[model samples]
Target chain A: MKIGIIGAGAVGSILARELNKLPENEFQLTVMARTARNGFTVLEDGIKIFHDIPVHDILSVKDTFDVLFIATKTPALLTLKETIKNMTHGNSEIIYALNGVGYDDMFVQGIPSVVYVSGQQHDEYIEHFVNQKIILPDQSFTYLDRLIQIIENDESIHFDLVKDKHFEQVRYEKLLINVGINSVTALSKNTAKIFEDDSMVRLTRTLLKESIDIVNKNSQTVYISPDFIDYAMEMYMSYPREMGTSMYYDVMANRTTEYQYIQGFVYNLKTDDHPPTPVLDTVVTLLSGYEKL
Target chain B: MKIGIIGAGAVGSILARELNKLPENEFQLTVMARTARNGFTVLEDGIKIFHDIPVHDILSVKDTFDVLFIATKTPALLTLKETIKNMTHGNSEIIYALNGVGYDDMFVQGIPSVVYVSGQQHDEYIEHFVNQKIILPDQSFTYLDRLIQIIENDESIHFDLVKDKHFEQVRYEKLLINVGINSVTALSKNTAKIFEDDSMVRLTRTLLKESIDIVNKNSQTVYISPDFIDYAMEMYMSYPREMGTSMYYDVMANRTTEYQYIQGFVYNLKTDDHPPTPVLDTVVTLLSGYEKL
Candidate 1:
């Protein structure tokens, strides 16, 4: 099976690295990147873990792949739209391994996957802080089994094929986590240690509760427990004190953030009946303001 | 009249400079500062404006004055409590020219004055951004008229003697302004230009409205119009694009912020019936967390 990963960001590069470790006879893996670089390196601890997988600029790729993974941030989807359109054949299955939800309909028969990984890329080297597992809904798709087989073969990477019934709930749980952690750390310019503060802990819980409320109201099938608020807070507080979210690093580097798909996505979900989320609204506003600068 | 200014910071230094310009025989002014520097310089538009006033270390101060002004930040009060007690006679009137409200009762016969000036000190030179009038309540005090007369004599500084009945209202108004602008700019690490963003503008108005609601509920004598929300937003947005608040600068430099008296004061006022102020609570928490660092 021919496999291609679009957008060689931290997530894309990490996925490419994990897939390259699979049996070459069964999976021919290639990475379509924005840059012209043929390969990327990832740093774990003090050692450099380099991946020499074949990489082509998205625009230069002409061959169709059996399976394609869209790993770019939501904002980059627009620029890659044409490239994606040209590279995917009628039989190709596209999986969006990104932070947001509700983008599955944006692409032709796209499968949205909740990525439970965190990393930052500096030039060609990516520094990964968290690499838990990727969760995908177990739905009827022609290439689902082959995709899972290739991913599951890698010992370093974890994959979970959750039942379709509980997919939305799992996706929202991850989204709510991102919404709270990313927004606060990004705005405060602090790290996970910020959650150690009592008031910050409360604020994080409140933000999570708001996001969960919206998700629960929008999806009748998924119900997020109020206790998940405390769970998320404890999870963030458990991370390294200096561990920063992607949004925090983006703001520090003055790059456009993934806020549009995270906090902004949550903000757009609010309706007349939904309770107002001032904290989330404030974070989105401040982040949007920071982007303008 | 003999007058001594305790806590020779930007406000104290400016007050000393303004008071030194008065007739020498009518008023004698001494500045008690943390440092032993005899005087400080204030730069306006790159020009050196030196203030050559007598300065004394707070611990070494011995003389009692007819009227005293406490101009240091709230955090500095603990170190200077003994000095303040030693410098004020039984008839001496003490005025706290600082940020935050409800501190008047903390000092022996302390009069809280709302200072509408804004500036930042770089080494010995302070940069004046906004030098609006200082508003004080007109009440029965031994040296109230003399204090106003001396302040009125300075053409560069403006003073307002509002009715004593509405003193808390005026003070709360200033507090609300700081609560909104200081917390947002400080946390966002952006300047007043952040207010230019529509979402940020809305957030600022919402924060101001929350503060006004609290103030209006606490004090029946003072009614802040809902329109004041727009007025405050416009006022902050009108500042120079690159201008930063003291709290913003404090966070940028890793100095202790005035959040305790500003947002913390407002937070302490919360009761069971009062509406929740997650925004203020978050700011105070984050700032408190920053201070720990």
Candidate 2:
């Protein structure tokens, strides 16, 4: 099957290398690269591993693929609207491995993954620190089944392609996690180790609680219980103390962040009856100020 | 006449050097320092000029001075209550060259100065960037007359000791300036260069406006006209973009900031009729989170 991945970020690089391990007949993968480099490097376990994959300029791509993964950062995800059409057929299923939510409406056949892959794309190298899992919708689909079969049959592929039925719940949980971890990490400009500070924990938890209050205010959609705050904090603790979230890396690098889709997504859903989100509003304003118009 | 300056920071160091230049018979200056060093190096105009002054520990301040200058940071200013008694007599005048407001209650004879000194204390060098004026309370005091005459008579002294009659207006203006620039510079971990960014301007201006509204709500005491917003913005623009505020330097150096006396002073005065301060609350929370409880 012919497959295409648009972004060369952490998740995109991981997906490209893992799927490249499959038999050539089953997976013909191509990573679009606007940069001149033909290969990428990943630093794992204190060692540098280089992957040689066919890189094509995304804009120059004229060939269509059977499956596509939209692994770009949330801010750049929309630019692929027209370019994606040139890379996929009408039946092609797009799998999105992104952090923020509510962008699924952009594509009808798109499946948003819980993007279990954790890493950061530094200037010269991508650091793969944790799980190589991408949790997809448990519901059966032809392209997803084929991709899962290809990965499951390969014992060498160190990736868990989780097809979970509770994808929605876990996705919202990931959103809450981003809302808590990303905001503090980016604003404080610290790593996961910031949680070691009690004030950091309290401030982050307060932000998380504000976000939780907003989502759980009504049962219309995306309901997260109050207990999820603990779960989210625990998840934060589980991360390597040195590891940085995508937002943290983005801010440190002086680039725009994914706050629009992560914090902005939750904050924009405000209503008259919603509890006042002072922390969220302040965070959003700061983030917006950091992001240039 | 004997004089004691408590802090060795930017303001303290500058005051010590300027006062030291006065004739020995006219002015005897001593800088109290716990750190084992008899001299300070000030980087003026790219050259390191060393000022060797007698350094005495504050706890060992057995000699009383005719005039005392409290140039310590706002947080550490209150710690000198007992030690100050050893350094001053009933007739000795206390001059405070610090930022923020409402610390007058800490001293019975404390004459707050709208300090015009601009400099930053780096690791081992103090960078004197701008004016060395110290604005004293425009009121009649005994020592004030002697100090002003001493400074005015010396042509070698580059410091402008301005005893403005409109000192109250300028002091409040300085507080508003800190409310706008210090908060944004500290929270953003940026220098005055951030004002070049329109979003930074908007965010900083918004913070200043919130502070203005609160101070103007009940004009029983300190009243600042709305026009001060433009004046504050002009001050931000007038600053060298490369220069960092005191709070910015503190946060960058991982030390506690002056938000408690600056932003916190403005925030803690909230009344029932006060306008909601979501931005102020968020800035305070983030700053408090940065500061250890």
Candidate 3:
């Protein structure tokens, strides 16, 4: 497989580096960065592995691959689409390893949306903070199995894909987790330790409950089951103890956050009950005010 | 009266500089900063005014004022209390120029609560983005009148007090505005220009409505008047085109935000409806996350 990862961010870098470790030499990887990096590199368990991969410009590159992974954030999806249209020729499958739903709404008309899971980026260093899971929607189980085989062949990267409605459930669950963790953590300027504070848990619960209601309203089928909280709690326990979300890092850098895409998007959705989103409102106001300054 | 400012941040620094203009024969201004800043200053309308203010260690300070202005944020209030208890004598009237309400409830015991109307603070260098209109509770009108005489004598600082129940109303009103603007701007990384955005207006309105509900639940007289949006719009127009709240600057500087005190406090309020506070939740989360990183 000739593979191209459209975003040279942490996830893209990790995938590129891991794919290079395939012993069968059945896969070739090309990565894309906003600017040219030295090459593809991944820091795993303190070992820094470098793959002398070609870093192509989204604008200047002209090539087609068997697979194209659109690893950029949703806000940058339009630009990614434009780049894909201008750069690639022939057929290529694009996988979106991003947070949030509505992947198809962002891409070219005919392209299939591949859901992805990988979390956080620190400079060129990609930390796979969560389980590496990628799912293609249209029952592409065979394709997923092959892809997993290629990836898991190397012990460094863990990945799997299950094309079922459960996948959507998991995405929404992840959204709930992001809602509970990302926005609260960003605003409080504290780590998971803030959750340990008993006073903060009620506020955290309110945020989580609002997300659950909003998700329930938007989705045709309810993704949140009776076990959703337990599911989330398990994931929370499994989370990298000291890791912060990408949203958290964005604020730390004083760069604009993905509020419009994350909480901001949820805020835009018109719902039945006026879900009290005071926390999100204040955060957006402060962040927007900061940007103005 | 020897006035002490515990945290020489935007409000503290500016208030210190403003109070310094008082007749040297009557008032001795001593500022308590986390670190020493020489000669407190506030620049407004390109006019630079310097005050020969003395900065002291929180614990090393020895003198008490007839009035002590505690302008540090609420989260830091406990720290200030520890220092103030050690440094000052009893009978020190403490003026807390904070954003949210309920200082009386949190007071260590017998400490007088003072609230004010100075709605905006630019930074350590700039002050008085808008006119100074300080508010005191209606019951404290006697103290207000005395402070007004001292402040207006300078012909520089404009001061006022909330008459009747309007004091509590205005405080809650101010909380609504803070709830709407501070964290949202910080999280979105947008400017006041965002308020001009329709999505922002809707999100802010929801927040104001929700906060009003929360406030009303606690206080019988407080309700969401038809004029709430109008009040905010007028305030926005009154704000300097380039001015942003102190929360904005704090996030920009990567310093911890006052989220816990402002949005988080309001969101945590007990209410019947459990109004959705998505905006507040998201912004607070994002800000908290930033601190973790």
Tell me the TM-score for chain B of model 2.
0.94
lDDT of each candidate versus the true structure = 0.77, 0.80, 0.61
Strongest candidate by lDDT: 2
Per-residue error for A283 in candidate 2, Å, reads 0.5
Q: Give the DockQ (2 decimals) of all models.
A: 0.40, 0.25, 0.35
* Decreasing lDDT order of the candidates: 2, 1, 3
TM-score of each: 0.80, 0.74, 0.77
Identify the candidate with maximal TM-score.
1
Instruction: Point out the higher-scoring one by DockQ: 1 or 2.
Output: 1
lDDT of 1 at B7: 66
Error of model 2, residue B21, in angstroms = 7.0
RMSD, one per candidate, in order: 4.5, 5.5, 5.1
Backbone clash pairs for candidate 2 read: none
DockQ (model 3, Cα): 0.35
Off by over 4 Å in 3: A22-28, A105-119, A137-224, A254-293, B1-7, B12-21, B25-32, B82-92, B105-124, B137-176, B186-190, B220-226, B237-242, B254-293
User: By DockQ, who's the top model here?
Assistant: 1
Chain A TM-score per model, please list them. Answer: 0.92, 0.95, 0.81
- Report the lDDT tens digits of candidate 2 across residue range B132-200: 889886777787787888789889987888788777777877888888888877766667777787756
| Candidate 1 chain B least-lDDT 10 residues | B156-165
